[model samples]
Target chain A: MSDIEIKDNPDIKSELQTPPEPGYSEWRKDENTLYNDGLPEEEKDWFCDARPQKARKSVQVIENFLNWARSQSLWILAFGTGCGAIELRPLVTSRYDISRLGMQPRPTPRQANLIMIGGYVSIKTLKRIVRSYEQMQGPKFVVAVCSCAINGGMYWDSYNTVKRIDEYIPVDVYVTGCMPRPEAVLAGFNKLKELIKAGKAEGQNLYIERFDWYKENQKKVIKDWNMPDYNW
Target chain B: METLYKELKQYFDVDEFSVQKASLAFLRVPKSQLVSLLTHMKDIRGYTHLVMVTCVDYLEQDSFLLTYLLHNYSTHCDLGIQVSISRQNPVMDGIHHLWEQGRVYQRELFEMFGIDFPGSPDVHEPMILEGWQGPPPMRRDFDTKAYSEATYSHRPRDHKEPEEYMKQQLYPED
Candidate 1:
């Protein structure tokens, strides 16, 4: 007898072809009311609770040019989560000199376009990673380094460590190793550049589209989820 | 160290005097006499530094062996005071009053072993495993492998044994 059931039935489908409400969709939200319910009342004002919106891609020619530019100047947020962070240090030194690839370390997440998830992500660190990933502007990329990030590596059976990082946040590229060498990380950067130039690296947008699924997975592991639903 | 132990034995109920080296020794003290012994060593004897507080779970014995390793900076000697407490009770007298660093160690013991240090500050609060619902993980009975498998989802494993895989790669014809 419900509206959904009526629409599904072939006999009643012809009689009630049109929906009761004109252009009314369950997915649409009232912009003012849809605030992050997770935060305390006093702290709610500190953060923007508006859901993440997908970035509109520009016309093909201009978008391609912009993607090329974005790929060239990849500013990575300097956040080290685990032991794999050791591999990242060598990239800046004279031996590797990652600056030549147009990638440089940025102090804050807001200013950076890329976040390298260096090694295993414990539930505790995953909370911070989610917050930082959310804070970064759209078209942002994640380069998860180490076999630990790829699967779980040595911590596959660990009670504290996360098995797959992608369940919480969308990962664009995975550089595999126990702790991938600096050379392998550079190769990963090159792969990311190729993805960017081809307009394939849309992890930020994919995250927004599958926001609910990611949040559910994140909330399961992170028991003390006291922060706002979206840290924005 | 033997002279020091002999002198202390007359005053306090100390047993099992073990000499690890010329500079290191260990002795067992009853639970009730632990605080007094540590105080006597610190004030009367020259063992002024409290090196560390550690616990070992004896599952078969149903007891937890708590060790308070103390050091004498002047003599360059280490004395470890061992006290065995019941697994059922799992309570210890807080030595936070004697050494401030003992408070942190007590807090860690409380978190890892479910041991209670009633008077110690923030002893009940979680140290590392925040909002952990299960029993104390460091307990011998707590099956970590089972807990991990139940809690976290795993990828379908396509892994082969290293020796066999290496042989296949090196000698494909065979």
Candidate 2:
């Protein structure tokens, strides 16, 4: 009976328990293989397949000066992932004008140094967020706004919404509120500025360091990962 | 509404006709005659606007009740046509020809309720819940809470009753 059962099972448990196939980190060093297996053969050439590298730090005096300058003139990418975007709108308005702190909304990620991930991130929206976050230049900082981005807030039990924003991307500062007022966002920005000036906010480098972990977490939820491993 | 219902009854095998208000009424029709009745109402009775196409899962009854709400712009009257389809084999006639927007609704129904509308364009394609692998979420049999728990990892909750928390905050000394 034991022999019959062993023959019938066919090692199903071992098959199910096998580790997932090697991700980007394992084969990223290889020059010949494609970075984007999801994309069609024709379109693969359009995207850059190069792996991200850590940005080098300059001399102490220059680095401090650069950090100070970067902190003062925070060019924020105006990408709203959820409802917290409504609060962000008021920051640009006359009442809560964010320009007073040298922070302004930049239309594109290429020019922006700061990104505010506003509110709950659904699976579909997380894909876009990851893409945008990757597109941003080095020395970039992330300011996760609202309770939703911090820990899923009201969408805690939601099937599609991602709970912690940090699992996907490194967050420099967190502003906790259920749709935080513009005042709280400004405060969060102030905290981010402090971190930047103190030379503590290095989320961009942290992302590159733990790229594999982030990618695995992202791929777990985003089933249809049709884009490149790295968006660049 | 009574007059319209009586008139519709004469042409189609419509049953369970009830007027909820002066301007709104609901009636159930056989699945086969749904398209014809909708076309008749649109062309003849002036209920031209297709407001929405929604479904209610009757898990106990082993059926799905589909509602096709139509609005008449001129008279400001809303008419809902209901069709009960079997749960085991949920399929419905596509009314995209009568109303172009019906295709979008049909697509939504297909994704949510797993109801197939054979002729509707892009009905099989996912409208929302992209790349979803589990059973149709909107079906009554699909346990959403269980699915959520199984699929998503939750934070360890330190929950306190709102009333108790509030009272504790306000009267800590007590």
User: Native-contact recovery for every candidate?
Assistant: 0.45, 0.23
Instruction: Provide the lowest-lDDT 10-residue window in model 1 chain A.
Output: A1-10
Stretches of candidate 1 above 4 Å error? Answer: A1-37, B159-174
The most accurate candidate by DockQ is 2
TM-score for the second chain in candidate 2? 0.91
lDDT of 1 at B20: 93
Residue-by-residue lDDT tens digits, candidate 1, A1-232 = 1331111234222322332332312322453333455568898788766777778999999999999999999999856888889999999999999999888999899999999899888888898999999899869999998888877889877878887888788889999988788999999999999999999999988887666667777788888777877777
User: Over the stretch B67-169, how does candidate 2's per-residue lDDT look in tens digits?
Assistant: 9999999999999999999999998889999999999999999888999999899888866677788888888778776777666555444466566678899
RMSDs, each prediction?
Answer: 8.8, 7.5
- Candidate that scores best on lDDT: 1
Where is model 2 more than 4 Å wrong at Cα? A1-34, B157-174
lDDT of 2 by residue, A15-109 (tens): 22353344445525563343676678898888888778778999989999999999999999866888999999999999999998888999998
What's the distance in Å from true for residue B120, model 2?
Answer: 1.4
lDDT on C-alpha atoms for all candidate structures: 0.85, 0.84
